[model samples]
Target: MEINLNKHISGQFNVELEQIRNDVLKMGGLVEQQLTNALNAVNNFDHDLAKQVLENDIHVNKMEVKIDEACTRIIAKRQPAASDLRLVLAIIKTITDLERIGDEAERIARVALESFNKAQQEFLVSMDNMGRKATTMLHDVLDAFARMDVDAAFEVHQSDKALDKEYEGITRQLMTYMMEDPRSIPKVMDVLWSVRSLERIGDRCQNISEYIIYFVKGKDVRHTSEDDIKENVL
Candidate 1:
């Protein structure tokens, strides 16, 4: 009889845990769409779409607040230990990352709406490519978290290095363009800001991937070597 009672309690906790996880995934879906819209706005040069992205930031902010409250309640009531605790901690951390990514997306949208002459339009092509890569990474990272796949998360970490290279190359090209045409400096500066925001979005996605890995393996892999993360996961 006692064994059955313990099992029932465990099952109940599992249900509650799954609910929280599902909510997190739902929030992730919203964030993913927000990023897509922001990138599209930039690529298409649509101020209306940019405004829409800015408006959605409010919804993302509300999700973060709700998720945090739910996590706190679960911790207080369930007193979850070990792996369960790690899951809650991970969701809390990831929500904060998602919120910040939304902020960066809004910033990108603002810069993207600026009027660009011919040369500036040409430079924006590189920015569009960079935005695509970062958005793709965010999509993959969220999928990895939903599936609780540490290997997938590791892939996201490695993918961020590509974004870093892209950012550096674009920034160098922009610097040369400014030197050649001083009149283009203002547009160049806006592109620089947008690229910086996109790069940071990639970084925040990487951080969320790390949290996913930590949730699955019970190991905090931040500041650890790539070899170490691979060894731990695989």
Candidate 2:
């Protein structure tokens, strides 16, 4: 991915920055596919696929450590200022969020191993829509990060509220099921945890989008109102 920022005169410094960004993208790709496989495992009751996703999380953790070290080295040796410093900080924050996203995906995959009855199956399937929404948000935010596109970042940030609504709806339905059939409570709770994981993944994706905005606009949009963020970016 090409960074649109100004290139430094020192070739080595530029290469170091570029490498960190590329590594972040690589980590993001792994986490994205991990989430997809985890979602598929739950939807299809594929035990082997879920196991694979769990195993692959180590790679995600490793990548996060590697990228974080790279960012630290740049900060210590190169001493980047302004946009460069923001870029490195963004990379550090993005990788941490990505790693947490990986953890959430792993949690969802674990639910696939549980035995759910036919009645509980619909609840699991109901989460598919929210899973897909979270995955799409992740994909878009990663794309925006690569291109440093503030507009795309803003759009992803705005789309998170819809995902939240979906989460709430599914949660309410699951609670109703738990109340009606006490026997299904165990399995339904499993699905509920998975649904919560997907919702958390969407939140992390939003955090990544905020990092993208911070890197490009140099504004800490965290805890800021959506309207305030819109005014800053636009």
Candidate 3:
């Protein structure tokens, strides 16, 4: 949304770049919707919604392949340099994370299919919290990437800690529920897997945020410390 269009001198190359960016954003929207639908399916135990999530996955996969090919072609023909090169490379990384997030969502949807009838609304507090956090993180990261806003990206990165804590608490709660009532073990396991998928989605969002910083700063921060990231990222 905040792309600097003035950097381009060639109209044709600019159009190609915009096309790839548009495709990437469109793919992001699909994954975001898939994640939301998957969470709702688990929250309400809606098999229909779960099925829809699965059905929509083909589009996400297709978008990834389509965007990847476009990026490759742009690199080959445009020979983008410096920051433009970074933009193309960052898109490649972002799409990979988005696709993985989609997989996690699909996995959660499958859990819904397995345990929709087993859902205990009262016991879903932690899961709901985590799901909302993941959804917000995903949305925020996309906005940050679009705007190239380092501060916004860092905000999402910081929120990942709270999401991780929520997942741990959910694990503990589910474990206790199982121990207290062995009869509930099967149901608890189903919810556990769903929580695991949600946590993984949060992780993928964090990875995307890290990539936002990496391309902005022109340095890899994957293995860097948080303090270092703060110091290094613009």
Best by lDDT: 2
Highest TM-score scorer: 2
RMSD of 1: 3.9
Computed on alpha carbons, the lDDT of every model, listed in order, comes to 0.86, 0.92, 0.85
lDDT of 2 by residue, 151-198 (tens): 999899999999999999999998998899898888888888888998
Stretches of candidate 2 off by over 4 Å are: none
lDDT order of candidates, best first?
2, 1, 3
Q: How does model 1 fare in lDDT? A: 0.86
- Clashing residue pairs in candidate 2 are none
**39, model 1: CA deviation in Å?**
1.2
Query: Against the true structure, what is each candidate's TM-score?
Result: 0.93, 0.98, 0.93
Regarding lDDT, does 1 or 3 come out ahead? 1
Q: What is the lDDT for 57 in model 3? A: 92
